[model samples]
Target: MDELLRLDGNAAAGVLGEVFSFEATTAEYACGGCGRAGTLGGAVVYEVREMGVIVRCPGCDNALIRLAHNRNRHVVDLRGTTSFTTG
Candidate 1:
């Protein structure tokens, strides 16, 4: 990925807020690939207008989350993460 195109997970806060009830960006997460734990705001984010947002683990470059909207609903995929927790 280009350095100019890279953005932190905070960039997805707006979209995440639409899907989650709380402040999703502050949620904790673990990467399935590297087992590194961190807050959502620490991950890498790539926003694609056509495909929505993709959040990746900073430690291992593993894709930890994917968010999108379609059919008047929000779509979230967390299969790439080992665990997710929020308080």
Candidate 2:
């Protein structure tokens, strides 16, 4: 779990790309059920062609519903960041 959280966006993208067999970008994900927000860190991959992207939420390991489809793009841009620790 720590390893999953530690993976950077690009690295996570690559892994998701391989899993889903489609190019993917790292996006910030929030749990629709719990409202927990963070970078995706699990292994499940979901591709929504209609949305033109895939979504995975680390909190619930589920797809995130777009709050603002046009305003904040789905991709969670954590370009030059590191780990997000929790207590």
On TM-score, the candidate that comes out on top is: 1
Per-residue C-alpha lDDT of model 2 across residues 1-87, encoded as one tens digit per residue: 222232223444643443344444434444654566564444244443333333445555444422112433433332222332321
Cα lDDT listed for each candidate: 0.87, 0.39
* Tens digits of lDDT, candidate 1, 8-85: 889989988898899988999999999999999989998877557889999999989988778878789999998999
* Candidate 1 residue runs with Cα over 4 Å from true position: 1-5
Q: List candidate 2 stretches off by more than 4 Å.
A: 1-27, 40-44, 47-52, 65-87
- Clashes (backbone N, CA, C under 3 Å), per candidate, total 0, 2
- Cα deviation of 56, candidate 2, in Å: 1.8
TM-scores, all candidates, are 0.88, 0.28
lDDT value, candidate 1, whole model: 0.87
